[model samples]
Target chain A: MRIILVGSDKLTYFLGRRFTSKGDYLTIITPEEEAAVDLSRRLKATVIAGDGSDPTVLQEAGAYQADVLLALTDRDQDNLIACQIAQDRYGVPQTVAIVNDPDNKAIFEELGVSVAFSATEIIGSMIEQQTASEEIRNLVPVAGSGVTMTEVVLGPNSPAIGRAIKDLDLQGAVVACVVRRGRVLIAKRRSYLHEADRLLVISEDDQYGQAQKVLTGEGA
Target chain B: MVSNLIGGNSSASKYIVVIGCGRLGSLLAGRLSAEGNSVVVIDQKESAFENLSSEFSGFQIVGDASEMATLKKAKLDKADCLLVVTREDNVNLMVAQIGRIFFETPVVLARVFDPAREAIYREFDIDTISPTQLSADSFMQKLNTHQVSTSAPTEGVA
Candidate 1:
């Protein structure tokens, strides 16, 4: 796929190497000439040194042929404009941007960016999951799928400790698997939950809270 | 045309928010303030405010125009008009969009350096000024007039 990346940071280099290794055509636009030269030498991709948000620069970077555009600039405004121009003018199918300010994520989405992610929000959510409780160990969101995988450890007082997987009242979630004493077991209908068993639940993103409540008898 | 868009001649105290205290922004804010209108100028750098004259009676805000926090602090909702003249075309476009779409400000004007980006601003019904295009057109007209006068004298001699 033809990919256009805006901004030249560590993330840019990582993505450039991964995509080029996969034989995908990559074009990188950055404002720093030195960084562009370094990136061109390191990665098998075209690098152009210019303002990524400028329409002329984007045109020169072959935005028209881009299957996806990723705007990872530090400035949210520049990232937003680069994505906007790539989508609106170049007819790129998908555009993603990194919002420096978490508050601007919604605004970027409202303005028609395909995906707008904030690093701070992601890190904050990870921290929240770590400090949430002993029972809930982790929450991993499946990007673009609207699904989440939550790892819940059953404690002595867990509501599902004595019940079978089929008996648990899950709204839109299912017990995908269970780990008991380091043994991975595929969850079956008659699989009985036990204390110290780690249940990996896959559920719709919005229904995770209800799923958590059903297993722990406490709201997420 | 720009002054007319802001309702130039009328003597009413209209609250205005001017983004970017650069040359154009400072000049516009000063003129509006002198005309008895309440004006507020916002810029990312405080030093940009030094361009404003002492006679300019208006509030100054040092913050990014593209951020919603800065716009809220400037009370953009209370403004009768918004003027954006930041150096970056994208910054000017973003700020003007926030003012026009989010706050639904009645009058929004932004100066876009790149003439190619003017269409997007006009699509949203925001007034945009392209200095490069404007100056180029003005220069072309002057060159044409000079040619006409010079050719007339040559024609008379012939």
Candidate 2:
């Protein structure tokens, strides 16, 4: 994938490295010259030094040809503007913005921009997994759209625990990954269940409600 | 009976609008309503009011409080005070700025999720509350004051 990352922060650098390691073409745009140098060296990705909110900078960074554009500046307004410009003007296929404030995620979503709440995307999912029941929470992409990833966490007292991953009888959910003690465990048919381990599951919008019940035991 | 119900001439009812109907919004709304003052809530998600009291009798609007349309729906123009308690610092800042600049609301309170962003919100002359920092500070204060008992349990206590 050709990914255009707009930000100079540590998180941007971290994501750049991940994309680079995946052998994906990555381009980074930042306002700081030092960040551009450091990240380019670290991730071996193309780095452009300029304000990401500027259309000329984005065009120079080759945002028009990018498969995914990430606007992850520390400033929410700047990130929103960058994503809007990338999506609306440059016609980027997929534009994601990192929203520091979780509440702003909705507004971004309303504006047709995919938002990744660093806090909620990571911490909330972890908490949800810790609080879910025994049924494995399947991770599924949003229906008719591959934009959003959804998962259900089984509460602690759920009856689904102690059962094998393949035995859950989930209807329309798929288990993508399982996280335990900060380790991402690949989902397998015979993986044994562990309490407080989060099953990274995904389901379409229509299947989310039923998937939540099958995984958490309350929704069913 | 009417005379008994009415307070002194100096004591007037204060209307408050609480944006973002999350835990903080619900609590503030309940508290203000309990004080015999009018309260209004604005939230994007309608499900946020699941835990709120029905008898509270406050106006609830399902929309982004930061937007002028939603704020006007909540009567931001006439509100005596505004509280932005959404989980996002940017939304809170936007709401506070709108309240201050457009509506000229007397008081605007905003919840800053990130401690690092507090100073930027403060620059707008809005009251900012950092739950993460404040909670940590309170915990440190308790530790420094030795309020938490450090004594070990005696044998066979279990």
**lDDT of candidates 1 onward, in order:** 0.89, 0.74
Alpha carbon lDDT at A121, candidate 2: 73
Positional deviation of B130 in candidate 1, in angstroms?
0.9
Q: Which pairs clash in model 1?
A: none
TM-score of chain B of each: 0.93, 0.83
A132-174 per-residue lDDT for model 2 (tens digits): 5435433444566842355445568765678777887766666
Per-candidate DockQ vs. reference: 0.46, 0.03
Q: Candidate 2 regions off by >4 Å?
A: A1-220, B1-10, B147-158
Angstrom error at residue B146, model 1: 1.7
Q: Per-residue lDDT tens digits of candidate 2, residues B38-86?
A: 7888888999987577546777889966556677778888888788899
RMSD of each: 10.5, 22.5
Task: Compute each candidate's TM-score over C-alphas.
Answer: 0.76, 0.43
Q: How would you encode candidate 1's per-residue C-alpha lDDT over B83-115 as one tens digit per residue?
A: 999998888887887888788899998999888
Interface RMSD of each: 1.3, 8.8
Top model number, DockQ: 1
Q: How much of the real interface does each model capture, measured as fnat?
A: 0.46, 0.04
